[model samples]
Target chain A: MKDNNRLLSRMFKYKECYLLVAPFYIIFSIFVIAPIAIAIFFGFTDFNMLEPPEFIGLSNYLTLFFEDDVFLVAVRNTLIFAVITGPVSYFSCLLFAWLINELPRGLRSVMTFVFYAPSMSGMLYVIWAYIFSGDMYGLLNQILMSFGFVKDPVQWLTNTETMLGCIIIVQIWMSLGTSFLAFIAGLQNVDRSLYEAGAVDGIRNRIQELVYITLPSMGPQLLFSAVMQISAAFSVSSVCMTLAGFPSTDNAALTVATHAYDFGMIRFEMGYACAVTTVLFIAMMAVNKWIQKIISKYADV
Target chain B: MKFKRSKTGPARSTAGDTAVFMILIIVGLFMLLPFVYAIIQSLKPTEEIFAYPPKFFVRNPTFDNYKTLSQLVDSLWIPFGRYFINSAVVTVVGTGANLLFSSMAAFAFAKYNFPGNKWMFSLVVAALLFSGTVTALPQYIIMSGLGLINTLYSLIIPAAATPLGLFLMKNFMVQIPDTVIEAATIDGAGILKIYYRVCMPLVKPAALTLVIFSFQGLWNSTGGSYIYEEAWKLLPTVLNDVASAGIARVGSASAASVLMMLPPCALFIFTQSRIVETMAFSGIKG
Candidate 1:
């Protein structure tokens, strides 16, 4: 009670500051926080859109784990997708940004555009659909045929064998987005004098300089990029849905987000979807925490 | 500080420079191929688009696909312009409100040592892990509760409070020298005055970066679950309908995508440098 009084008094002292932040917190609570709370609450219930939620403790989770084969496939696919794309995308963003940072300003901007444009153009990723389209008219098929690589037009999107691979390619294509930009800026902000000092300290190669100076200086950006890439990799759905149909060829490209989307939107199984999403939320937070620890450890070194 | 193009210590050998250039060019071309293909496809005549042994270059380019798109738009149940208007209102209002609110909140977090400041900022950061897909269903419930369902506000309100804007703005604002704020306070300026008159100007690059991000996001938004009314649908939703019609509408689909891409690309081109500038201060060290 005494602590509460002190806190309240402190808040009153910073009343103007509270007023400034109130709008964001209010809207954030209503939209983000409240919904998350409600979703967790509704996760236990078996609510269709029409009826009020019926409280059923742990049954939904039991069904999800024991009965749902499709959900299991989704979890498997999501893990695979995140594992491959997360590190690949993060490193590539760093590498490309570093390379681009070496160019003359005019060429640098153009290259940045070339890399960043795919991610920015909303739904333009469908162009990849055209390129990888399953017909003779598809660009890849045509090229392959002409080059005598394959006589048959490969069904890239429809084939279960190749569907996930195609989605990964497109995901990487779009992944050099916010993180890439942040890295370039971070590289720019790195103190150049450190490099000259490192040279004097017998840092002979560019790689050595990068390790001793650039990486440490970019500690924050690296962390930010890792978080962005990890979260994005985990929540891969819309691109999967667009390129390959939802519930694509034997659910080959199914992911956690798409699974939630399937139950929530298509099937109207609101409670099941909430449960799926809640699990996803927990998984993402866990991975985020782990990655943060690793990155901060490396940064400190 | 001006950004110098080259490092002084290591004189890069020509062989190394050539290797770097070669790799950059190859990767750059790979990154650019789909976009180039889309533009070419959009321009190709009907026969060229579906030609056997599909060619990389268009033999005869035409505006016919764009014409077809315009006709398709005109034939929609609601006026085609209504979707554009809806998108514009959502983007402008959403972006404006988000910038204002986020910057205000950012100012408090950065400048004031208020109680709960660290806790509140951490909450904002934590919210980043919750993707839109996870929250869509619950957001719909909240929207329906507030009677914002089927309204543009359903899209706008949620977007206006996104965590990215607040995150970016606060990071940028933290870089401003504390003495500047002290000077403003000494001049009898209030908190609001210092925020707008002093701090906002200093963070223009960050504000511009936020504007670009917010604008692009809101502009591309399809008003997913919360909006059901055809009249309230954004442009992308309507254009997506046109694009998904079938193989017959392929030309129009490519044209629709190119049209969708133009505004954001144009905006990025103009402000690319400013975005890079703003991102310099965006690092989040623990």
Candidate 2:
């Protein structure tokens, strides 16, 4: 059609721009976009690594929903993890960033480093494993015993009751990362004249100033941090695998992410794993869209 | 440099200031405790490491764990230096590729009014929703299909086009005034010259922040499922293996973590201010 021809001509006219962006799009198509397409396709098929995918016509999904008990548990655990960690971490990141923003520059940078250190350190969360080591010499166990809070070492990692809690704690501890920094930057960029105007406009306390001026100004950062936190909360895997062994005590910490890893990597059930991840992908997209809509509405207001 | 906002804004009461200081200190300590514990554990003598009712402070600090770590490295089947080299090469190359590709693409997205410009950039943003977990299985399939399995390119190439880098760079680039670019074009500068000579210098903070992010990610990456050969394993993988040996290697494990943490932390310290400055401009709103 004429529209298609015109679009093609426009593309040709801006070929240099296309050429400049080609490297990213090419790699992105291969690694990111292609994988999502393939994953969706593979979700409806039966394939292990060694075999060609056979069309299975929604059986994978049916089995995932009705037949797989572990999948249900994984979904439930993932939801709980996301619900608790997402909001808590987001608020904490905002609160901490706002507080740190008030400090003198020298002290502020040091405080930022202290909070952000745990996140940047590679595999240093393993230190948490030792702290929660379920042994007499473990830091937490020793402190509890000395204080007479518990009679004996608690199996924090191995116990189904406490495993998820330990993971959540560690996640929150490390959660003050990019989003936190974003909040700090966002706070710094808030117009100072507005604060002065608000003071003159009878904003008597810091809390009033924060609500009237700071929070509204920080809408974009709040959205960014929300998205980051939600994604991070849903994709909790490596820490779970490290602290509580894979398929933790009775799948206490078996999030959807680790479930997919279990099937795809460990059991070679690629089709089933793809189906599981497709569900996660859909859930994440829906939630992300919903949140973005809400935040953008609020921000516009 | 000085925090002038506090002086300009509503006056803080003594009680509120004290409470704020108290809460920050408590939270800061909580955030820092594990790291302090790890360093202390790493320094403790072997006997003290395993001593019942673990102490917070190391009484008899020593470097024996570090010595053991070096010895353990020396005994690895693959030379420890090979793993370090692999990690260094991956981090440097991956970060460089990411910066170059992302900045170019960002420049195009920000400055060009080409067909599919809006659509393609939105796709880049949408891709951020799909974390690595969602794509891991299919990416593995793609990697094998492309014969990237067990190769460094598998790690580097996929990482080079991350959405975060592109998002950050594009947002930064959009702030560059159009009149400046127009002036450059009028002065007989080509698009590439404008990008390189004019825009790149102006967006140095964003570029530096992108480098920090890419470097931290690549440095910490254990090559995941893509890498299998011991010779191609990164430093983290080697350190992890040592750490998982047993409780007897606890000292060295802690020592390994401390060593692993140093580079990123050091990089962060040097570039902290620039990173914050960059993030200020990264507001996602149009």
State, as a TM-score between 0 and 1, how close model 1 is to the true structure: 0.90
Model 2 / residue B28 / CA error / Å: 0.3
iRMSD in angstroms, per model: 3.8, 3.9
lDDT tens digits, residues B1-286, model 2?
3335554447577677778778999988989998898899899998998777678899989999999999998998877889999999999999999999999999999898999899998788667766565467778879999999998999999889888888777765765668888889899987788889988867665677678778898998999999998788899988989766987898898898889888888887887776554434542222
Query: Model 2 off-target regions past 4 Å?
Result: A9-16, A190-205, B1-3, B8-16, B76-79, B107-113, B131-134, B171-206, B229-231, B275-286
Give the DockQ (2 decimals) of all models.
0.45, 0.48
Instruction: Indicate which candidate wins on TM-score.
Output: 1
Native-to-model Cα distance after best TM-score fit, residue A156 in candidate 1, in Å: 2.0
Question: Each prediction's TM-score against the native?
Answer: 0.90, 0.89
Local lDDT at A151 for model 2: 95
Q: How well does model 1 score by local distance difference test?
A: 0.83
